[model samples]
Target: MRRRQFLAGGTTLLATAVAGCGHPSVVLDMDEATAADIANQVSISPEPGSAEYTVVSAAIENASSTRRGRSELFDRTDTVRIGDSFYEVSETPLESSEVTVYEVRLDFDPADSTAEIGEIAYEELPAADRQRLDPIISDDNPPSGDGYDVGIGYGTTQEVGDGSVFVPEQQYDIIVHNGDRYRVGVSTRTTTETEYRYEATAVTSGVDSFADRVRDQYLFTLTGLSEAEREVVEEAIDGGYFQDDEAFRSVTNRIREHEGLDVTDSYGTWLLEYEQVEYLTYVEW
Candidate 1:
């Protein structure tokens, strides 16, 4: 039997070997404000190259005909140049429905800032490696099954099955709490048949250290929402999230905006446009 594997744009590693032992061709320049701005915007917990989990958003590409989902490309391997250093990149697709999210993972060894990798094309990799990377660009549609679809923002939904969720790759979301901005990511899934439990915990530094948080995993269940909450979601879907919702009707709306969707169409149309990532790193049990 073929060994089942996660496909592209998921947690799959793109580059493996260090290629040549020679020096790096491109010397990274992380001094620019753009570098810091990008780093800060994505939320890098602790310092980079500390051998700990560091999340970064390298680039954000609006949805396109070829790239159906809003692709967030990350540098998991020591490929992309970041702030005068090269760190491994990890892409984790947090949730998929109307929007698909991929969390970038970076690991830096303080001394390896000058790390070097070959600029080999995707086709140059070994046959096995090439096959592994095939799913990066796949034609899989999002699933519509019997389960509670929890809204996580950006028109994304978490399909809960087997009463558990596992996010191996660190995917962060920007949210507002108590009139303050915060970055959040889930590491575990906790739920029950009726009530959903969420424990707010603050443990990350950077951005706003004082921001409230429910670290690791933010437990929320579909049935847990009060009648009013469910009504709001239903209303948004009925009226078109982008049409009647004041928060999303404006051009400044970041999370709900999508270039692929027609300006005159409704957000609910995403259901037909919704396609699954070529691969799934997390399985819904």
Candidate 2:
């Protein structure tokens, strides 16, 4: 339950409490650009105040539904932040067969020219051992049976009578084990057909917005290529995701370049969230 919770009072009240409460601390959207900007301006000095913030990425998708999922960390908190800012920081296993996906965003302030959005796309990867994921041993894997790491995640398969299940259509069936062996599974559909989600319906959005934009550009880039180039593009998309490797790194890299910056870890941030691991704010400076 150590997750983000936004102050209830309207923006006016919350902003005052955070920015004017006799402290130099600022109230920034849960985004990296905002964090970087604040850090540059005033040296983000943490003083036991909360770095956990919310951004309401999508405005009231459904008032009734929002009320329902509001309490839990998963179930779509809508507004989520990474690391201290929207730019999430994380350490990952070299290769994991199991995968989890967390989509988080980083945003910028309109007035701050240096501020820019950061998009994170993580795939809670499984351990590299193919045998651990072997259909024969899936039941033995720690994540198969019981609890999954993420606060909110669902399963497509189930077990009955302590027996391995059979799947005819699939060359292999995923085994269900119990205990701490679970990981967040992204969309079941192939990474090939991607569905695009924007913050607003002609509405509003940001860093996560940039992530979405870049993803769009990549798909468009892949589509725009000629038949010969399309095959390479398809291969690139098939391998992991444009976000997971150099294929799409430049999409966000240019944002940094235009700002006259050298290199960036923005894409790395996205990879972390994909795991669906829970994190609490911890900043040294």
**Model 2 ranges with Cα > 4 A deviation:** 1-50, 54-222, 240-285
The lDDT for every candidate, in the order shown, is 0.25, 0.24
lDDT score, residue 49, model 2? 32
Candidate 1 similarity to native, TM-score: 0.15
Q: Candidate 2's C-alpha lDDT? A: 0.24
**Each model's TM-score, in the order given?**
0.15, 0.16
The residue-by-residue lDDT of candidate 2 on 183-209, one tens digit each, is 222233211212222231221134445
The 10-residue segment of model 2 with minimum total lDDT is 276-285
CA displacement after TM-score superposition, residue 70 of candidate 1 (Å): 31
**Native-to-model Cα distance after best TM-score fit, residue 248 in candidate 2, in Å:** 11
Q: After superposition, how far is residue 82 of candidate 1 from its true place, in Å?
A: 7.6
* Candidate 1 deviant stretches above 4 angstroms: 1-34, 43-45, 48-83, 91-248, 252-255, 259-285
